[model samples]
Target: MTPTSEAELAELISAATTPFAIRGGGTRVLNADDGPILDTTGMSGISLYEPGALTVVAGSGTPVQEIANALKAENQRLAFEPPNLNDALGTSGESTIGGVAASNASGPRRIAVGACRDFMLGVRFVDGAGNIVKNGGRVMKNVTGYDLVKLMSSAHGTLGVLSEVSLKVLPNVEFQVSLRLADLSAQQAIDAMSSALGSPFEVSGAARDADGSVLLRFEGFEASVRYRAESLMKNLAAFGAIEQIEDQETCEALWSDIRDARAFAKGQGDLWRISVKPSDAPEFLEQVQPSKTLLDWGGGLIWAELPSGTDIRAKMTVAGHATLMRAGTDNFAKLGRFHPEPTPLAKISADLRARFDPKGLFNPGLMGDLS
Candidate 1:
């Protein structure tokens, strides 16, 4: 059913007899085997754009690229830099703004800027009881009660059907540069990245390949970026073979690919997204030792594509936190301690579900049934 308005959306929700999953462009939807998908693409629109206030209120179904383009026209951007999950999924689907916030998708810039949850200012959604609810507001400092807007940011549309959203935007940087370090061991590269991050220099992206190559990005005014790059190179000469990528097109493409995890796509085996302490990355990789891996988030995130027949859960359990990226299987990622514990939080989550979706109609069991 096409829900052109909030009341129509709520009506559809109330009439959904079978369990239904809310879909925004169907990018991340195909990741699971949810029943009876309810598409929200028809509900797209931009409700408000306050350039002076650096905030934009848009329909949840608006494509992220559309929002980005709209912001870019005014020299602004989504500070969180949410990733294009569709690219990682190897599918051609529009990544809606709501989907990004709902998935809490963050890319390389997350280390410097923030996550989707951080940028989300407000959300308007229809609960399972067919009630329209709004939280937060279009401004950043709206001291409203409960701050339920953030609660729904990464809820994956399980609690409600997001109809509208407000987000914080930032000005685009003047210039961007990437520094590449080749021929260092994983531990050495991670150490170098950590060191670079510690310095006064503003490093935006830091990543390493399995082959021990490190790539660091710094964005700012041309002079500042250049100066930082030169200083960073001199500081980490021990890592070996320093090369600066100054070409705008090349630098943007490289970082964009990294942000989308395009470099790790379609490996010889199943893919896993692992989050561990940056310092422990080398040791963890050595322990699990996947055949192919790409280290990002300054070694905090590991995209490991393990060989067939490997025990993904067991390996990940040993490595602090892990999630199966893709495997043509039912269970996508196994939750670990890094994920909120399932005791009191689980009870609270269930209570919230009882309030928003008492009948358990919206994407039940998507995040593992809190009920």
Candidate 2:
């Protein structure tokens, strides 16, 4: 059932007789189960918009495109540049603000700015008990209790169903320029990206293509971008001949592809999103040889397409976790979709899950069987 209001949403969940497949846009975490569909699309709209203060508050189900358009009109945007994974996931899942938060979906820009949780100032949601809980105020500085706002981010809707959200927005960069270094070996690519990121040029995005090319981006005033592009080239002359993609259109398209990991979308086999230290990225790649790999977040984030049933965890030497981005539930269960937590951390996670979702009513096992 679609809920149009928070009150209605609480009532629906409180009355549900069976398990639910918690869904926001049906783009990510497609369904709760075959039991009942709690589509949040109906509960959408921008309730408060203060462009001057750089804050936009909207219902959880509000379309991300709608919010982007609104922010565009105001010369502001969600700094994280969250990706629309509909294409990447091969699902027509239109991204919603709430869904983006739940997935913690950040893009190439995450290397510089932060993740979705970084800009999230506040959240309002119905917990598993159907109680409406609000945390943090709409403004950027509101803080009076436990940081549930961040706790909910990336929780995959296991904790609760978000109702409303408030976020800080930043003015869109006036100009962005991309520097490309072609045909660098994986280690060379990582080194080149690392150099550009560590320099004082203020890089906004960095990634390596499946073909082993490295891309570094700088965004800011036109002159600043140009200056950095030149400075960055001089800094990395030993890596290779650096080329420039100065046109905003091309630069944006390239970053978008990298952000969504779109190149691996239509490929065969399972897709895994691995997070590791940027410096350790190259070494990690040596252990896990995938059919195709794309590096983003300045080599800190790796997206690999390995054949289904591949032993993913066994291929890692660095301290990092591999998440099965696209896979069957049974295989995920066998392979452990998320990184296995250590004993102490596992205990804390189990306590949190049990306390918040005691009845196991919300998207059962969505966050995995922590207990």
Candidate 3:
């Protein structure tokens, strides 16, 4: 089912008797729900973009590349730096802005700026009852009341199907540099990343890749970036001899690889996205022993690639949550896509779903039982 306009989408939802597998670009693989596929890509195009104001409003189905091209032309960008997971998910589809928001897919820069939700200024969506709801506004300060703008960001279309989005953007950095510390153990890498992030020099990216290399990124005007990179290099000298990636193309490729989890893209395993306290990551790594790993957000986000059907939750001793980001038939049913929440949080989630989707129609059972 493809609706080309917001009104058509609302009308379709109003008359829908069966559940819908709401899809934006079909890039994000979730538990398959039994229903007609409602594709948002038909409602595509940028509505408004004010470069001077650093804001872009676009239809939910607008391709992310389109927005990026528009922003690049203006020397601005989405501050959160959302990742394109098509390769990682093994799905060949255009990545849409709505999918990015629904999944709250922020990348390494999240450590410095924030998540996709933070840059969201407003949203226009269709509720489960087919009501067209608008929340927040184009500017940053317009947020208030229930903060539905944020609530819808990561709702995965359970509460509402996003029709349009307004985002606050930032100016592109003048220069960027990356410092690499080779062969650091998990704990040492975490310690080095923590120290770099804690320093006054604005570290935008901190990640440990599969091959045991820790990379830290800094960006700004050329002089400021150079100063911070040199100072951080000296501070991290005790860890290992630092390798500097100063070429702009090389640095961008390195971070892009990290952002998309390209390391585990073609591997024969289920990919999991785990979140834990940065301080707990070393211990967590020791416990799970994933076949391959990529640490992002200074180890707060762990991308673990393990053999098929491995119940990673059973091996977890640290306090964290895991989402099976990419799954095969082996463990998709048994493990479920999202990690189970604690009792209190589970109840709160259920209540919210019930309030917004009383009929249990939108993406049923995607996030667990909505009843």
Candidate 4:
């Protein structure tokens, strides 16, 4: 079922008796239980764009690439740098901005700028009860009352079906430079990334490839980028000799591959995205010893690929959460996709769900058993 307007979407949900599997672009594959599918692609378009003000408001179904092109024309961009995971996930569809917010997706730049929720100024969504709700606004200061905007950002379409979204943007940089340190061990890679991030070089991207190479990215005006790159090289000399990648196309392709974790795109094994303190990452890797791993966010975000049916959570001593990003259908049902929330947080989640979805008609079991 595809609704072209918010009113039509509300009416459909209001009249529905069964659960709905809300889909936006269908890029992030999930093990959705059987139910009627509600695709949001029909409800897409840019409603408002103010380049000077650095804001863009679009329908929930607007394609992210479309938004990117528009912002690029204005010398602006979605600073959060949301990743397009279609290739990695093996899904075929446009990557909608709504899906980005729904999953709270962010890329390598998240370490410096922020996550998707930080740039989200406002949102319009239809609650599971079929009521249209609005929060925040086109401008940043327009926030009032409870901050449901943040809540809805990562609710995974369980709290509501996003209809529209307002986001803050940043100007594009004039130049970009990448520094690489080759053949570092896991700890060495983490240390090198940490040292580079700690330096005053404005390291926008810090990641370690599965092949033990650490990449550091800095972007700004040409002069500023050059100055910072030189400073980073000198400051990080203790780690190793830094190789500079100054070619624009080459640097961009490197970051894009890192942003999407393209290494595990077609490999065998279930993919797990682990979030841990940057300092604890080396320990976590030592314990899990996954077949493949990619480190991002200065080692705070770890992507590991393990053999199927391996419970990563059980082998953990580090204080972090591991989310199952790729797995078989039955495994999703048996092992779950998200980490179990603590009792208190679970209660709060249950209360929110009860309030927003009184009929429990939205995507059921999408976030695992919240009963």
Instruction: Write one digit per residue (lDDT tens) for candidate 2, span 1-371.
Output: 88999999988777766677777787753432335767888889999999988999999999999999999998888889888766666777678998898878899888899899988888899877778899987877675543788899978888888999889899989999998899998888888888888899999988999878899999989999999899889999999788899988999899888887888777778888899998898788888888899999888899988888887888888998888877655666668567877788878877887877776777776556757
Tens-digit lDDT string for candidate 4 (299-342)? 99999999998999999999999888888888777778888788
TM-score of each: 0.92, 0.96, 0.98, 0.98
lDDT (0 to 1) per candidate = 0.79, 0.84, 0.90, 0.89
- Candidate 1: lDDT of 43? 76
Candidate 1 global Cα RMSD? 2.5
**Which candidate order results from sorting by lDDT in descending order?**
3, 4, 2, 1
What's the lDDT for residue 292 in model 4? 95
Off by over 4 Å in 1: 29-33, 317-319, 330-341
Query: How far off is residue 142 in model 3, in Å?
Result: 2.8
User: How many times do residue backbones clash in model 3?
Assistant: 0
Residue 339's lDDT within candidate 4 is 89
lDDT of 3 by residue, 121-220 (tens): 8889988888999988887766654378888988888898899999999999889999999999999999999999999999999999999999999999
